[model samples]
Target: MLLADSPPPELQTLTRGQYDLVEYALAGAGFALLAYALYSWTSRSEVGVRYRPAVMLGLCVGAVAALSYLLLFLRWGAGYDLTDAGYVPTDQARLALSPRYVDWSVTVPLLTAELLAVCSLAGARARKLRASTMTAAFLMILTGHLGAQVVGEGRDTTALVLWGLVSTAFYGYLYVALIGAVRSSIPTIGREAAVSLRNAAIVLLATFGVYPLVYAVPVFVDVTAAWLTAIQLAYSAADVLAKVGFGVLVHKVAKLRTAEDVAAGVDTHPEAVWVSNVEHSRAVLPPAQPPAMATSPTTPTA
Candidate 1:
């Protein structure tokens, strides 16, 4: 059935106008953040080559998130109703399939990797942690996107609730993994870097918790355009915290690690002090002692 054939909700035009205004403002902010992230990535020489990859990953997270928000703004500005086309009769298509989900699907895993990478985990352990963390993060976002799809389709409340629960479970697992990864790195990366990484992870997890709350509100209560606006705004704020803010935090951790390496002289010479000494003495031998003759003379005198 055509959307025009069905009765529309009592949408306040003024509310939509306000939403548009807010979206535009957010878009501008997103652009600015994106620019900053790119600049940071490009100017990574400030942190030195050792930290470039980790810092680049963080910058990528910010850039991707800002791009996502800008896409959402464009979607909202286009006036395309989310509930425009669906098979279910009661499923009035209101939730526009905003590109936010698309963005999340790509960026979320990268964000997880970024968090883990800045810790400078070594060899096989780093690979394992990155794999596990990225897997969990990908699952978390996948389930959440699926749940959003179900809700957008006007599915039964029970279905929506179940999806929400599943997504939440994935999120819980993801958070635990993130914390574990950060904590495990303390012995390797030092307490300062570990603490910084932990704080960034916590900030991300905390901000992400708000998404489910914002999503649940509309599912259980009467939803209006204003409420939709609130959801968008809340999500935007969370994105900034989780992505841009977290990126900055990750950068700080990388910077700290770089400084520590420089101070320890590891950046220039990675060999242990004893090993360095051995290498230095390779061309020289200890002077031979006339020990046997000295001992014999002393014994005779006694």
Candidate 2:
């Protein structure tokens, strides 16, 4: 395993100090984010029931992200060193698994479903879209996780590169389905809500793109204290932006959709008749015109 041995004597003190500093800072930030998400969830009484699930899912995303960071912080704080292979404990503790990948295994699928649920139309189309998006998301994350595991297991670099390409392809498919296919259906919610959903997708795709770059850093640079620090910090920042920031945008879209429903005198109850009948629910708008399919050859290329 790379970095299985101690650092060179000249760098030992600096490495230890930097590790402690970064770990503590990340732990504190994780707790703070978790607290904020819980607070937001507790204060969600005013949100309409029809929109409540999406809001709750957003909070779930935040909570999962916080847990990932906290786990990493704890591992480092316990004297586990970040090696190219994985985390190695300095003492008698067992080897620590990668919390970030575990976090993604849970959160990525939920995130995909949340985004789709928020912008969903009130009919069969919604069901189909949600299922497809969720499946693609799961594939994307699974491939990425498997690739990382292969690399950590000392598999050939060629295997890692092939897996990376496979994962990237899956990710591309998800972007096409989410941003391309879903964008056409957003108008069923409301104009303002549609705008919000589009913006949210853009932000999420942009932030999520950073993960691959951070993951690839170790492949190019030697696994040193500074390299590990950069990986942790970059990933932490991406998590904050993708999960927490995207959650805020989702909340905004839900709020706007709820307001539109209220203005149109449409019941916002989860079991309301209009909730399942897209035609009736969207009656406030002009006679239903089929939304033009908007396909982008590239969409910020998530």
Candidate 3:
């Protein structure tokens, strides 16, 4: 049946306009940053010629990841029937209420980007790291997709059983890959501890800080309007946090592109000899300091 045909729920809810305004605004900002990063990377990329496929794959995955979320919203909006007894909420309502679609959409693109990033890293000489990254990316997508599917659809035992198996496997992979990535990416005690601590803190906050205030109160608050509003608000807040985090992550990745260029330049130029030697001894090379210029007496120093 068409979305318009869906039964109306008893709830007199806000219009789509009411719901999506913030999402659209944040998404716009997110896209703008992505565009800038892509442009910057393309312009500065030295090995651009070699990693064209990887880049394209990353973009494609990114698009897919984005589509996943869009699909969720579309499904959520479509699922609800606001006029019906149970609120024959269109799929869109279902999507929003469930959170699966958003999860899948977000995770898929991230996984794709990550896989491509791993490939790029491998291309740049982090062979072990690349392998680990790819494995982790794949598992994240797999489990994330399964979890999303399970949550989005209505109750079905067989479907759950089948998807549950897939989910389990994927989750297992996620654990293994995450461990591997961390182990390979950071070689120092302090750095590893810091990274671990930071991630743990973020997860802790998401669970303890933002979740209860915005989400949990609704169930106990015992007013339908209050509950829905609280839930929606919670989701909106989460979305904002996610976009902000992703924007920062992408920016960091963009910075890495510059680092990669510097690395590539060193490899091709005469200075690589020293850097390469340093990498072998300490497993840490000095930051790729830009070529120090000979300041001539008459040259205007910027």
Best by lDDT: 2
Candidate 1 lDDT for residue 92: 23
Candidate 3 residue-wise lDDT at 79? 55
- Stretches off by above 4 angstroms in model 1 are 1-17, 48-50, 80-97, 151-155, 187-194, 268-302
Residue clash pairs of candidate 2 = none
List, residue by residue over 1-302, the lDDT tens digit for candidate 3: 11122222213365455345534643553454355346434533322233334344444434443444455446545655544233344435534544434443444334334423422234444555445445554554454335323443323334434544564554455455444443454442233233532353244224223432432232223334334544555554554343334333333333333334445453222122122123211122445889989886787879
What tens digits encode model 1's per-residue C-alpha lDDT throughout 36-138? Answer: 5886677575454666776777777768777776666655555444342311212222433346677777777888887777765668988887887778777
> If both were scored by lDDT, which would come out higher, candidate 2 or candidate 3?
2
Alpha carbon lDDT at 170, candidate 2? 77
For model 2, how does the per-residue alpha-carbon lDDT over 1-302 read when each residue is reduced to its tens digit? 34234441112223555566666668766876697588658746545677778778877877887877777777656756566544444751221236677888778777777777677665787788777777777777777767655454423355456667887887888788778655775757777678778888988888879877765554444456565566566777777777777877777776666667766777442322222223223223334589999986966845
Q: CA shift at 80, candidate 2, in angstroms?
A: 4.3
Ranking by TM-score: 2, 1, 3
Q: State how far residue 87 of model 2 sits from its true place (Å).
A: 13
- Quantify all predictions' global Cα lDDT against the true fold: 0.64, 0.66, 0.40
What is the alpha-carbon lDDT of model 2 when measured against the actual structure?
0.66
